[model samples]
Target chain A: MFSNRRSDDVAAPRAGRPRSETARRAILDAAADLALAETCVPTIDAVAARAGVSRTTIYKWWPSSAAVLAEALLDRFHESIEFDDALPVRQALTGQVDALVRLLRQTPAGALLRQLLAAAASDERVARALLAQWMDPRRESAAHHVARGVAQGDLRADVDVELVVDALFAPVYHRLVWGHAPLDADLATRVCDLVWPGIAATEP
Target chain B: MFSNRRSDDVAAPRAGRPRSETARRAILDAAADLALAETCVPTIDAVAARAGVSRTTIYKWWPSSAAVLAEALLDRFHESIEFDDALPVRQALTGQVDALVRLLRQTPAGALLRQLLAAAASDERVARALLAQWMDPRRESAAHHVARGVAQGDLRADVDVELVVDALFAPVYHRLVWGHAPLDADLATRVCDLVWPGIAATEP
Candidate 1:
């Protein structure tokens, strides 16, 4: 599930009427739309015009255009993938990885993510926004699930949770960025199967 | 070890004097220097000027500035890390990964690589150059090593060579680009240890 923490709420207290959920949704939607339609990150003015909100309104909510785009990306990811708690830890991990690989391969969000990553390399603001808005939240969710799996004896208690999370997910992004290999449908299953023996608890 | 295949040699046969090795080396060195010194990919003209070679000479040797930079990166990587054939498979892999982490963390090559990756995302030429000149060679080297391990009975014969290579190296690059965690001294050892159980041949 996505967090409800909006940048505007955390920036400073506002004396005006309660923040408009409608406006916030419109801004994010517009940002995502513009980012997908163009080769570059959408500008603040472009987003504001597309959303029919004043630039001041966008500025009030997000610190930068990259922040707005990051939120839009995070929103799309949340909509596309949901972790099923009822599944076994291994199955759940495989399913999550499979869904992510598919999202990156079969959607506009994939292109959007590539664009953000490219921009983040040069722009510190973009990098910070991506980390705070997108990568951190996703990593935290995975880490928590991994920790639970460890406690339940599905995974080894000695597992390094952060490294395990990286081992599970990093290859997907690596392929996505490097283009050295295919991000084929079975990649998730293959990756999980390869790392499973190292992370799984041994039978008594 | 780096391959000796030059892009110029593959493009077409040259009719004149043998290609100048001195010029080639100078061009690659200049390209690497400029890329590290600047935030953006240096232009062909800038590289030529820096190396004291004409634009035509650079063009004759490399199809694009990115190609030149890719070769430069490949050169630096070869200089920084060498795989010792005498070591056990696991130790060699661990050493290779650790050396790469150090190279990325402790050298200028790291910044140059980040710049190239950022540029590659937008420019098809850069992407192709990076894959052909840098990523493929690196992956090929790792693949050969893993295949050797399997042949030697040090690794599971059923292991996916490409995926195993990815597992060992991708996390380092992932952290490099994402900055989600530190590429510390022990990262390579930890990564190799985590994946070793899955990769190593089970004891009879």
Candidate 2:
């Protein structure tokens, strides 16, 4: 489940008004832009300046630049996943996997993820945000989908959804993060094939 | 094929004899140490300080810190791959796989590999050296073992060595890089089983 880190005190506020949504959007956009352009860790000052806002203003909502970027990227991912209601589970899963791969392969969001990971090696706050906001939820969603397949007897009940998601998806991400090789359609199919046999039910 | 960057240098005679092996060893050791203990990507100055030598001395041999670290780490990996005289192909291949997995799971070398990958994302020099010195050689050795399996009639000659290796081993590497899951013995065997069906001769 997603965390409600965003404040909910606006209902009975004694304040003049709620925070401007436009300002929040600008700060998030600026944070993502800095991360994309630098392909390295972005600083609070850099993001604030790019957004034409004060550092205090930027920090009021998001705890750090990584948090801002993570939320922004997650928002985009959520939007993409919203349109999968029309597809069958298998097709939906395949499309979702492909989208995740393409996102990591073709954009600054991928770079930001790696940058966050590198920073998380030394920064506890960055590490927590990465796990809570990105990896854990993504893992949960993939597990939910796989668990449904098991319920329907499309997949083996013994299949560990968590491990399957990692095995099925990590190679593309590994290549993306490590810059080892390209993750093409062939490679994606190889990944799905390697995992499908174990996931699929073989006998009654 | 390997890049010609390092090997293409002309063997020019100098007024004095070449750099001492002792100094070279010290420099290389220092480079690896600094990279592991301090910053993942240690500067030349840091390496020199660790070695108890001058930056000029390091610069006299290697062009960059990446080059220095690459040679050091590459030397360690080369020393790690053992070649037993009369081992069967399966035993040999499994030994090599186990050794590589052990290195990734249980050694400082694994951390160093991840460090190099982080640097590789931002530095092309580091990327090229890592591919040449580490990734390529390991892949070649893996293919060689598979080829031996085919010769011994344990494996189908028609199976693509590279794809089989990638299918069996890439998930392990992917797990290491992504930190999504730990690489365990059960997973390793599962990967081997998944790939072996396609690579081994069909049942009579």
Question: Which prediction has the highest lDDT against the true structure?
Answer: 1
Query: Taking the tens digit of each residue's C-alpha lDDT, what string does model 1 give over A41-97?
Result: 799999999999999998877878888998887776674345766777787778878
TM-score of each: 0.92, 0.77
Model 2: per-residue lDDT, tens digit, B147-184?
Answer: 87888788877766766666666777766665667777
Residue pairs with colliding backbones in model 2 are none
TM-score of chain A of 1: 0.90
DockQ of the candidate models in sequence: 0.79, 0.29
Candidate whose TM-score is highest = 1
Residue A30, model 1: lDDT of 93
DockQ of 2: 0.29
lDDT of 2 by residue, A159-201 (tens): 7676667666666676666565676766666566545665677
**After superposition, candidate 1 runs with Cα above 4 Å error:** A5-19, A37-40, B1-19, B37-40
Q: Pick the candidate with the highest DockQ.
A: 1
